[model samples]
Target: MSTTAEAPSSSSENPKKDTEENSESRLYQLVKNLTILERRESSLLELSKKRESFPQLAPVLWYSFGTIAGLLQELVAIYPSLSPPTLTAHASNRVCNALALLQCVASHPETRTPFLNAHIPLFLYPFLNTVSKTRPFEYLRLTSLGVIGALVKMDDPEVINFLLTTEIIPLCLRIMETGSELSKTVATFILQKVLLDDFGLQYICHTAERFYAVSTVLSNMVNALIEQPSARLLKHIVRCYLRLSDNPRAREALRQHLPVALQNGTFSKVLEEDPSTRRWLSSLLYALGGEQYNVGSNI
Candidate 1:
């Protein structure tokens, strides 16, 4: 009787073990294809671009359990590897695809405010903060900037206020200082959008310290482009300075401290073909004080 009872007990445990194994198999089956991530990003990118077609995308994905949270889980799971900076391209691409999804949410007006309310952008800072020069990290930083880029591109004051309350300005400035040319352009664009807003303009110009911080970065980028020129980047730099000149105090500061490169033919070669950028340069020079500053600009 003892042996019979023992055999029945052992058999019962085997079925439970098999069921657990089956559950594990089910999960692997569910998550097996990394392409699922890629496909989702592609879909969301289309949704962001043509949101009118998929009008209900915002609510469905925003409220879905595994949508944003699932995307974040992908990031948080890889958080450890970022410290020693061991994050791989495969992993970075995966997480960045998820980030691209976040960008979709951020771009959609319906989701942008709530996305900020929930502090979704905060989770991306670490990726932006990583100091690695490797392509993986650079791509991560650029994609991360794209999310912020989407927000500012809307020219919303509430978005700027949310950014001002956070460390976004400093973070973007750091990227402006250390990121790639494309990255710098995006970083500068965010700053430009912020400064374009009436409140953002006042807030940044409220203190001399803040004013100099942004001016210094724009000045540095102009200097760098003197050697390795990017017409796209220069366009935004000129626009940023032009916007800054809107503030009386900032305009006075620029009259004295604006980079000499802008006043001369330093970028004459690059601007020769970029009429729109040349126009921006003209507007910036005109705003600085007088048309005399446009002497050698060749704009």
Candidate 2:
């Protein structure tokens, strides 16, 4: 009797163990399938391979973000190791495919917040250093900046706070100075959005370190104006400066830099040439309490 009871207990445990093993196998297959899908390229059988993956990936990302946080960690980790940034690796193309998919996902308004909430900016900001230093990474850098710039457009306080407190201001200044015209335009958009609100101005003005960084940024923008007299970028930058000077603390911080800018005569020279530039420059000058436009004069 005892032997007969023991045999049934052993048989029952084996079925439970088999069920668990089957569940694990299914899970492994699911992960493998998703990973392959994320990196899939179009082939004879799969004409829209990458495009098809986005919709599939988006929901999985949305529903399973917390559970598979390591997927994001891996995504962020593999960025610098991609083709242009590094030589051909075993999975360079795959990683690039994944990042490109991510960029598409971020571009969607519905998916954007969830994607940003995953804290992708934290990973993305460091790539700007590579962008600043390497030619190969320039395209990657510009695309990355475009994505981050798009997130900034959301104007979420969490995103804005992260941007303001980081080295992003200095990085944006550097890109504006050294990046290609298209990159420069995007960098200015980032800068413009960053400094659009009182919060950004106050953030800069409240701290000596930030105020100095922004002062340097303002100087660089003025220099950009001098270099590219006809560039539309300078027009937006001039307006950005005027917005900065609106804050009392910012006005005071700017007061110290006004003399050097005015002394250079870049503004004076440009003022006579571009009417729109002149309007923004005049507003900037007035904000700094330096020069008032004479309503009756040619100015």
Candidate 3:
């Protein structure tokens, strides 16, 4: 009876061991394929997304393996094609996949600091700076922003400071001014995050030229919204204005140049269901409440 019982237990153990070995084999294939000269970017993206389900995956891919370096290598291999804008859709899609993996690394707390320390994000600036409206280039720009956006989404002030040292603001401002609505919204969200940081707010308000640059993009965004009217985009735009209001100089400027549409109720119906945005709009007005002023070209 004891021998018979042990036999069934051994059979169960065999399948569990086999399953573990199979999983490990698969992971090894994914990692090793990363070193291939013609690597599969889509495979990297799949593994990166899997990190969401397995909390330890990103750290392991980032630290114990060559995931970040592999992705960067894959990205740089295609960098030379951007200047004259000869990048094909196939190439853009491949690089974007690699970017998705890099974004995963940027977002994970354990790997985020080192990712910044290496200045890995600088590799992506060209993509962000691209003016191509072509779908391939647009997708590339948006994916690259995802990496930067992940970095800023963290609560660390260092992330904001590091980005400030770079030309992140100008690049984002350009995207805010010209990218598609979805891209514009993402760029605005990044700016909004930076402004929420005390140092970021001070930095923008530190110079009139800088302040004017920001306020102008915001004004243009508001003008566009008046005609097209995107509630989601408006939400981010309002949050940016509300955060800027925390700065005294910025607050006064806003009061003097707050968009007429905002004060005159163009979005009253738009915000009917968005209580949080409505509250933010109200608070923005109150922050600038001491006086009512006219909207003009000065912003």
Candidate 4:
């Protein structure tokens, strides 16, 4: 009776491809669940404390960078249109979870490259812009800053170039101006790392608007505090100045700001007491002070 019913062809099936597809699906599921874990306020702090839980998600996140973008986009999509100050708990939870995932993703060296390659700054800027505009939402603000800190550690060329092209420096200054102490610490860390590169310093020096922001924020920070951790942050600030002043345009920028710092004895105060921080600032002070300020004793 003619042919037997045609059998579905096993020959056309690819076992290896199926296995990979299944594995990817499993990894994605893991990310989704971890994100869910992040949203519950009761579990949020617990999740952060458990570092062991992070590696499970890291490999998948590193390998599935597109998924990270998609997750962030989806979270933003469902978020309330209200400002950060008035964000509903639901919206805040979603934003918190998304940021936590980003922080974890950015933290690992293996994962960091994929994150940078994925142009995370582009995906993240919308959220960052919101956080910058709203000074409250402490958790959201700190988490956003933490993500920036993690990216700074990567020091990737593309990431640095992207930062230079954006208002990120201004954003960091905004945090410094109004955010919590932890946030200010993170913001300072961001500027310190950003200025570590010649390109970043040059960009700040050449761009009048950016130069103004950097100078003003740093000046205020030094005026505000200089002890222990604050002193530590000042060390980074002085080191950045040293690098910035090395460039002709940046030196001019520094020279103009130096008078204000000197007028307040901000530079001299550090030199008098904080021996640990004194070393980094002395050269910068001398450079800014020209030949009159002897820094030879620092050696």
User: What are the runs in model 1 whose C-alpha is more than 4 Å off?
Assistant: 1-56, 291-298
Local distance difference test values of all predictions, in order: 0.81, 0.60, 0.83, 0.65
The digit string of per-residue lDDT tens for model 1 on 95-164 reads 7767766787888888899999999998988887888889989998999999999989898889999988
Task: Candidate 4: list runs displaced more than 4 Å.
Answer: 1-47, 53-56, 62-70, 77-84, 88-94, 131-136, 226-229, 259-276, 294-299
Q: lDDT winner among the candidates?
A: 3
Candidate 2 lDDT over 1-299, as tens digits, reads 35543445545557878986765554434434444545323221121143454344444444543423534554576665643557243343433444554565566667777776666666666556554345445665676687767767777666667777765777787787777777777887887787775577677677778777766765776665565664466666766777877778777777677535443454565567678867766666666664442322323
Q: Name model 2 segments beyond 4 Å from true.
A: 1-34, 37-100, 131-135, 165-167, 259-278, 290-299
Model 2 / residue 205 / CA error / Å: 1.3
1-299 per-residue lDDT for model 3 (tens digits): 35543445545557878986776676667766776656566466566656455455557667756656778887887778888888899898888878877887789899899889999999999899899899998999999999999999996899999999997999999999999999999999999999999999999999999999999999999999988999999999999999999998988898788787777778878888788888888778767873452222111
Which 10 consecutive positions of candidate 3 have the poorest summed lDDT? 290-299
Clashing pairs in 2: none
Clashing pairs in 3: none
Model 2's TM-score against the true structure: 0.65
| lDDT score for residue 237 of model 4 | 66
Instruction: Note the residue pairs that clash in candidate 4.
Output: none
How many residue pairs clash in all the candidates, one count each?
Answer: 0, 0, 0, 0
lDDT of 3: 0.83
Lowest lDDT 10-residue stretch of candidate 1: 26-35
